[model samples]
Target: MLGTATDAYQPVERRLGITRRIVEVLAETGHPFSVVTKSAGIERELDLIAPMAAQGLVSVYLSVTTLDNELARILEPRAAAPARRLRAIRALAEAGVPVGVSVSPIIPFINEPELERIVEAAVAAGASSAFSIPLRLPWEVNPLFQDWLQRHFPDRAERVMARLRDMRGGQDNDARFGTRMTGEGVWAELLRARLHRVARKHGLRTERRPVELALFQRPSKPSAQGSLF
Candidate 1:
């Protein structure tokens, strides 16, 4: 998988073409892979991806945090706009790629309110699956995110942190394996239930699509060259 925990299609990748090269190699080798990103820039690879997708060799997930343009700008300033991402979802789905939507890092009282709406919009744009994760403030991100909240959402910053702590066992962050991804409190349970309900209502799968590993071909080793004495 690509861009599952870290985005492979960042803006810099456009100029570097590293992700593109990786996709080319995977396509050439008939390896099945999945990608997740918030950038519509992935559309640039449709030529290679669309073909692999035809053989069920590739799938893509677009992460749409919020639909409000202003909120999206402040939240994910560098990523593609919500509308552009929806367009990319449509394009990928139209090309037969198994496209999904991730309304992730759900910040309570922020973008959380739009969970249902975002899933509904993505479904309308051809997404076949959906998933979400509550906001995680790991390591130094805890303080940094708090500062950000104080700056951008001063009026509700305290409330936001208070609710987040309630979900994090009265702490700023929890790094436990199982509970890290999905919080363990009543709020977290409610978030999970809400997502599951909405996903079912829209006929979207909440689980990820399994990639076909049997199709992966091991690349041949390069022949050793004789050294010139």
Candidate 2:
């Protein structure tokens, strides 16, 4: 409510709107569960954009950090905006707005080198929690990602695929419920190890910060005399 979101940022919010609709509809249908999904989109202009949470409105920014190869993955140039995003998150933090930084799509080979930098940037920006999701390709995303590798960096594309296959259990993706977010076997172990090492070194906890749960007050009823009349 304190900043202006430009045209480019609006469409990014629209992408998250799909999830918002699902949450609203599920609540209307007696789903009996409270769903709160946050922190994704074109994070370049995240500060300018704010979505209402249970309390007032706040902005949730997630950095995807997509890369071509495992090496490129580590050096994945800071996406869309380097300074504005940081400034916004810092400003919001000082304003007492809850903030979370997501180093998402932590794909197999590439997501290693920049891990510490990412965490440091987030901490410097006043992020309260750190979360990450591994790379996944349900349908065409796998092939599209592979081809993107071929087009951009043919030199090491084959090695990248090999490492991905190792983590993915000899496949491009493993869609099973338990293994979807994390790959399988030895390579997956290494990926997890590196992440843990970097996370600990930077003092970045994996859990999100706690929100206040004592703010609910029921709607007031009419006074007794008014009700009687």
The most accurate candidate by lDDT is: 1
* Candidate 1, position 4, lDDT: 70
List runs of model 2 lying over 4 Å from the truth: 1-61, 64-79, 109-111, 209-229
Task: Report how far off residue 28 is in candidate 2 (Å).
Answer: 15
lDDT of 1 at 14: 73
Per-residue error at 115 for model 1, in Å? 0.3
What does candidate 2's lDDT look like per residue over 124-212, in tens digits? 87865566666676697888888777886688788888877777778878888898877788867766676667667667656644433
Q: What is the lDDT of residue 18 in candidate 1?
A: 98
Record all residue pairs in model 2 with backbone atoms less than 3 Å apart, i.e. clashing. 70-109, 70-110
Return the TM-score for each candidate structure: 0.94, 0.62
Q: Model 1: which residue pairs collide?
A: none
